[model samples]
Target: MRKGDTILFETPPAIAEFAAVGGKRESEGPLAARFDLLFEENTLGQETWEQSESQLQRHCLDLALQKANLAAAQLDLILAGDLENQCTASAYTLREVDVPFAGLYGACSTMAEALGLAACLAAAGFVGHAAAMTSSHFCAAERQFRTPLVYGGKRAPTAQWTATAAGCCILAGKGQGPFVKSVTFGRVRDYEIKDINNMGAAMAPAAAETILRHCADTKRTPGDFDAVFTGDLGIVGTRLLKEILEKEGLKLDNHQDCGLLLYDIDTQDVQAGGSGAGCSASVLCAHVLPALRAGKLKKVLFLSTGALMSQITFLQGESIPGVAHLVELASEKEGQA
Candidate 1:
């Protein structure tokens, strides 16, 4: 059923299993222990950084399936994406799996977008089992979107580190707990910020807009959720988002950004924090889902924000447009009632 801008799932899809994989730097972060697998090297024994990113997605999917006690043949569909040209990372990752695949490109918001779509399909009986995954590699993103590592470019203070990470979640029509209750797809919003280095500022307005819309659509307030998570907004974008929300009469007290939670910004030299498609993906799988399953969090909102800009667009001096997607998750106890 649809309510305002939100799609309320009549039968909430359960996150049957999930996995998180991260690179060396992420393994050094505060949430390191939460990740299922960590690679000491960015390459993961692959010939190229892009190939390594593919491996990250592949490994995450494999792990999630293993945890669910399901095979690739049992999966009805796989929705995946990445921060690569043509979404090659996800395509190559599933090439040998022999499953129906759909590629998505929501920039950094790919995870939430993929998960929301998968949940909708699952609830509608279109698929019994589906996988949603996304990945990003620091080296590959640097080579594609900015200067190559060899350039030794000086990053701005507001610049964020693109994480070398991946996450996968397998949703089933019926399962144990941690259900996806609803979803809100965000609209594109451009703030006319041209600096490619400061993605947090470029994406903050959209985050605010989406949060406000979701709240109004559901007739809920910040107090209704145990927590609100914004994907990869970093330090700068997070502060801006709060300010924007405050001005709109919404004061969020239990808010956290996956960017900030993924790393120890002060000592990590990550400038603002982490930012990438994989940043929130890995964090959601590693930390948030577990909390929901354990009943530590009764209800929560996961919002993934993205800067919808390409290298070509940035080079052409096009202003960055941002988007955010929201998914409502609840524990089994709450979902059942």
Candidate 2:
């Protein structure tokens, strides 16, 4: 059922299995041990960076299916997305898989968006099993969005590193716990911040708006959730998000950002932090969902933010618009509510 800007599922879909794969850099990060697979090099035996990204998605989905003890043919649907142009990485990755596929492009918010749609379909009895996955590769994103590695472009301090990682989660109509309870889709919020290097500032407003809407629609406060995670809002965006929420009389004491948690900023060269579709997707699969399943957390809010801008739009001097999608997850005990 619909409640204001949020959709509350009568029968929440359970996350049956999930997997995370990362590149060399991510393997050295704080949550490296949590990943299901870590490639020594960014290229997973692929000739090109784009092909490597496709390999990331394929491997992540395969691992998830293996963990679930199911084959691709058992899935009713597959929703996938990536940072590559036209979402080609996801398209190429799933070409061999026979499952029906839907390509999404919410930029960094693709994971949350995909998971929300998958949950809704399962709860409505449209599908017995669905998979939600997304990926991003640093080399591929750099080549597409910025200058090539050969250019030696200087990055701004506010710039975030695009993580070379992928994550996938299989959702079923019936399973043991970590249920998707509700979803809140965000509105496009353009703050006229045209600096392409600072994605956090461009996306912060949208994250704040969606978070507030979710809380309002659900008649809950930030304290109600065991933890609230934002997609790729690095240090800069995370601070901005908190400031925006604070003005509305909401204090996020339990807040954590996927970008910040994925790497050790003090040691790593990632300016602000991590940013990409894979940033949150990988962290969610590697860390958050596991905690929920282990009974270490109860109710949690996962909001993935995205900056909707194209190279053409950037060159045209058009302002970037940001969007965030929220998915509410609860433990099996709380799922009973």
Candidate 3:
């Protein structure tokens, strides 16, 4: 094996299920209650995304490393990124953990990008072991990028819910673990969907294009893989994905292969879907891990999709740009390791 070659995703407690455990009754306010449902435990009642992101990464990384039985120094490389512009959240939080690292930002698709780079390095014998981590916070992201929740403003139907959480994965050189067979990168598309009210509309094209590329580059059909998932395109983005993919002669099954809409909290009432980098990371950490561990899922594709356009960019008359990253996660084949 090479430096950053083999990748393994550590299974962790599901965010929704974990949030639901010893579940508390729904609280007041749709947005507030929505956050409470997803991150109440990790949040400790923080009202802002900045606060939540800071706290969650610190705790989540510890749990992830523990589950993997990995020490900070054991990893030769730590590649991290997130939805936050400067990525200081992961920077500051990761400081508590001792490791050499680099900060990255691909919006929602950050984890995939980091993994993709890690895999290339490993495959090329650049490094032996690497860890990729990314996270998001609803309060911090919304206030800085969108409208502050304190104003009690009404969000449009297209608005996606920002999730508060974190996710981390360890990639080994070539030692008995899930192998990252390949990674497919997508082109950026600016769709002019600047409403900020409809991020799903903005990010759907990116997801569709990337998924199409993955199938094309790998010479595999949608049916070839057990699942083809997207980051946080939400309900509307998923709808757009179905339509767009069909145009390109590709189709995705939401029930089986997609990861667009995972937040089902009753209070959020977000008609479109979930948003933010954490939306995908949290769901992958929760649902995908357990399914793989149970031996119920064999091969799965994870596409972390993101809308690159920021609130200020939209206000500045720039269109909402999008990008999607594809990662293949599969357990070892019979006796291959």
Q: Which candidate would rank higher by TM-score, 1 or 3?
A: 1
Off by over 4 Å in 3: 1-49, 254-261, 265-268, 333-337
Give me the runs in candidate 2 sitting further than 4 Å from their true place. Answer: 333-337
In the range 200-299, model 1's lDDT, one tens digit per residue, is 9999999899889888988888788899999988989989999999999999899999999999998898999999999999999999999999989989
In order, the Cα lDDT scores of the candidates are: 0.93, 0.94, 0.64
**Candidate 3 per-residue lDDT over residues 1-337, each given as its tens digit:** 2113223223211111111110111122222332313433535555645656766766666665666676667777778877776888888777777888888888888867876777666666666667777777666787778777688888777777666666666666665545566667668987778767777788888877777766665566677777777787777777888998888877666333223335453545755666667667656666664566557677678888877876677779888888888777665433221
RMSD value for candidate 1 = 1.1
TM-score quality measure for candidate 3: 0.83
My TM-score estimates for the predictions, one after another, are 0.98, 0.98, 0.83
The predictions' CA RMSDs to the true structure, in order, are 1.1, 0.9, 5.8
- TM-score for candidate 1: 0.98
Model 2 worst lDDT window (10 residues): 328-337
lDDT of 2 by residue, 88-111 (tens): 999999999999999999999999
- Collision count for each candidate, in order: 0, 0, 10
Error of 1 at 261 (Å): 0.6
Off by over 4 Å in 1: 333-337
Per-residue lDDT of 180 in model 1 = 95
